[model samples]
Target: MSIRGYLQILRPVNALVAGIAVLLGVLVAGGEVTPVLFLLVVAVFCITGAGNAVNDYYDREIDAINRPDRPIPSGAVSIRGAAVYSAVLFLFGIACAAFVHPFCFGIACLNSLLLVAYAARLKGVPLAGNIVVSYLAGSIFLFGGAAAGTDGLLLNLPLAGIVFLPMTAREILKDAEDIEGDREGGARTLPMVTGVLTSCRIAAVLAAGAVLLSLLPVVPWWGWWYLGMIALADLVILYAVASAFRCTTSACVRESGATSMLKTGMFAALGVLLFWALIG
Candidate 1:
């Protein structure tokens, strides 16, 4: 397979974003930007890449119908090759984490297993899959804290909740988008079981909750800058919330605009954290 195919299998953009999240967590938890922090970022990135590869591997058939252009379904990569790549990346990621510290290594190991389980089985379950994926997203912050050698790691919980709510909403929207393929593939997703309208409502509520949780960080640690940045992020979230409410058709939810809006909001919130770390 071509190198480009391998990169595509890893979903490099998402992996890069995951790495950034790790760094933001480190910064927010007052972790010094040392070699160990760098190692943790690399570890998180590798496992995220592995997760992406394995997700494609397990969803190859579903992707063939829903996303025929994906690397695995489009003849760019073989199943066995993708599996091997995933295993190697996972091992490397875990090795990096082990070198950092016991706590980080433990988290890395657990996250890796959870990623595998999410891709291999949990994705087929309604709501459970959404929560698992959200937890994975939120855990990146915790992983960052552990890497930084912080005793106040629990401080990351508020931010984790902030991340979790929006991500859960986005995953639910994604499920709604992929309902047709999921149904054909025998995947029991929220939209497939509860119907798209109900799923949309649930996602909207979750988005709203995320908006509220975004303010929890404005304490002695964060100030006006955080509030201003989060307010901007909230505007985007509001737009996404409106979209979810207005979505009467599955096609509307399936379009990239719907989920893209939510992603933008989440990343914008992340940018706020990075900004706070730098100047606040």
Candidate 2:
């Protein structure tokens, strides 16, 4: 159970999903694939692992209070061990990114910095923490394109803003549900500022906007596959958002998180095929 829990801490599933989006973005941006993808994946893994370790470090107090079963506070892994691991991962991530491209290396630095900030300080701020995390979560895709020497092929600023901003809003909503754990741990997020219901409504609005934004890249530059995937993703996201709104309960929101994550994963999974086809 400890091994499994620690593996969950690694969040490999999320890393793989994020990697998919990155590869798709790279392909769409017309980057010639030559082992660059592998390097990018390694970089993602390291940075994400480091981020996990740092979060554990900063959240030690919170975990003791709210998540007593976690690795560090629960005696599964020593805090020193976790810190050393995090430092190693971060170093490895930087090295991997250095082999990719300067742009990607810079992005890795930013990601690590933001993760540390979120873990140490930003988490208590209203909405700020959620935005930081959401951007970090979605940035893997953007970095993939950047690594391939594509400035903004598949994931332009507009595209990223559209997808990530809404995701940030949703993250805030999640904080609201985790208020018990968060409040106990002394984190003051958006829901703490406004209210749970208000946060939920804000998430709904963002979800709707994300669905709409998925359609923007479907013009003459793109084709049927992109269109189809966008439609499919929009349908799935809209349904999940609607359910979250209608249900309006903590249990319901938790379920919606799973549903939304699944749908988001689907969207990322299908991106490669769509963008590969759209490459001019």
Candidate 3:
């Protein structure tokens, strides 16, 4: 594959977001910023990139209709080549995690399998696919906490929920946005079954749930700084929810204003968590 193909397969921006999630996990669990944390971040990044590539491999046909510019659909990378690259990345990620901690290794292995399963089959199975994606998003925090070799999973719980709920919402919105290609490809997504308006309402509900959850006690050592930061994050989430409600057509959802806002909120939340952990 060409270097451009490799970069496209990696989805560098998403991988970086996932790597930062691992770092936040360490900070939340009060783990020392050792070289081990760096290893964990790299492992997560590789694994996430692998997942993205494999997903593209499986969704090549659908992408041809929905996203012709994607690596596989555009012929930038062959399906077999992408599959091999994904396998190599997965193994390398597992190896890195194994060197970090036994718990991290176990999570990495399971996550890799789940990623493959999602790409191969679950992605077309309606709500099941969306939930699986949500779980994968939440697992980043758990994987990070595991790398710390501590029992402070509680520290990671709220962060996991924060990531999970909004991701679930986004997954549904994406399904709604891709309804045309998905239907053409015989996908049984929620929007296909219940229609776009209903799916949008469901997504909005999930977004609201995330915002409400954010208001409760999350970080044990958090102070006013954390509260203020999180409140601002909540507003961003709320705005996303509002935008979801405003989306009157599939085309609007495809524009993904709400999804972008959610991503921004997630990154802002992580920054706040890191700062709070340091100052506290």
Candidate 4:
């Protein structure tokens, strides 16, 4: 197996983004740069990479059609190798989390199991899959907060909500985008069962909810700076919602475009959180 193939299977960019999210979570909780915080970052990175690798393993057949360039489909990595790699990463992540705190270790174990279940079974189970994925994404903040203690986890709840809603919307949009491949793979996603128009409408509603949630007051120190920065993120999400709502037909469902905007808006929102955390 090529080293690059293993890295590609890990989807390092996405893994890095998850690692950064953990750091943001810690910062938002007013956590100092302790060694435990660093361990959380590493733990999150490995777990996220494991999730991606396992997903690629389970979706190898689908990738053959939807994404032939993926490591498994492109003959860069064997299916067994991918599975073994994921297992190793998951173990490493759990080990690192064990050093941080009991809460974090628990989260790591739960998330690791959820990730495997998501790829192996839930991914084909309509809205169930979307909810699981959303929870997993949102829990990254909770995981980091746990490193700071219980109060930090409580403080990060709103932040988790902010991430969860839009992520759910994006997951639905992605299902819509991959309807054909998903159908061929015998997966019953929301768009497949409910149709693209209905799915897009649901996604629009979820995005709108995220926009509303973004307006809630955060920590005292964030104050107006958070509001101003979050407003820009809200506008971007609003645009995505509008785009979703405009999809009157299956042919009109610009799923990729809408999802891309939502992702950009999420990154912007994360940036706002990071800025406030640093200054506060």
Model 3 lowest lDDT segment of ten: 146-155
lDDT of 3 at 70: 93
- Tell me the lDDT of model 4 at 254: 54
lDDT of 3 by residue, 1-280 (tens): 4789989889999898898778778778878779867888899999999999999998999999999999998889999999999999999999999998999999899999999999998988889999988998888988888866657456788888988998898898888888889888877898888888888889888988987777677666656666778889878877776787766567988675877887787677667766676676
Q: What is the C-alpha RMSD of each candidate to the true structure, in Å?
A: 1.5, 3.1, 1.6, 1.6
lDDT for each candidate structure: 0.85, 0.71, 0.84, 0.87
lDDT agreement of model 3 with the native: 0.84
Judging by TM-score, tell me the better candidate of 1 and 3.
Answer: 1
Clashing pairs in 4: none
Candidate 2 residue runs with Cα over 4 Å from true position: 1-6, 64-69, 148-150, 153-155, 218-221, 246-252, 255-280
Q: Please tell me which model should have the higher lDDT, number 1 or number 4.
A: 4
Model 2 clash tally, residue pairs: 0
Model 1 per-residue lDDT tens digits across residues 148-264: 565535757777888899899999999988888988887999888888888888999998898887776533355666777788998898788678676756797866376889899
Per-residue lDDT for 1-280 in model 4, tens only?
A: 7999999998898788888888777877778878657888889999999999999999998999889999999999999999999999999999999998899999999999999999999999989999999999999999988888899899889889989999999999888888878889999999888888888889988988888888876554546767888899989987886787756544465543888888899888888877777777
TM-score per candidate: 0.96, 0.85, 0.94, 0.95
For model 1, what is the alpha-carbon lDDT of residue 171?
Answer: 96
Q: Write the per-residue lDDT of candidate 2 for residues 1-280, one digit (tens) a residue.
A: 2566456566677666665556655655666566766888778887887898789888888788667877888787777777777888888988898888888889999998999899989999988888898788667667877865655534455456556856765686667667777887888988777776777778778877776666666433556767676676667666656666654455667766734663564465256344643464
Backbone atom clashes (below 3 Å) for every candidate: 0, 0, 0, 0
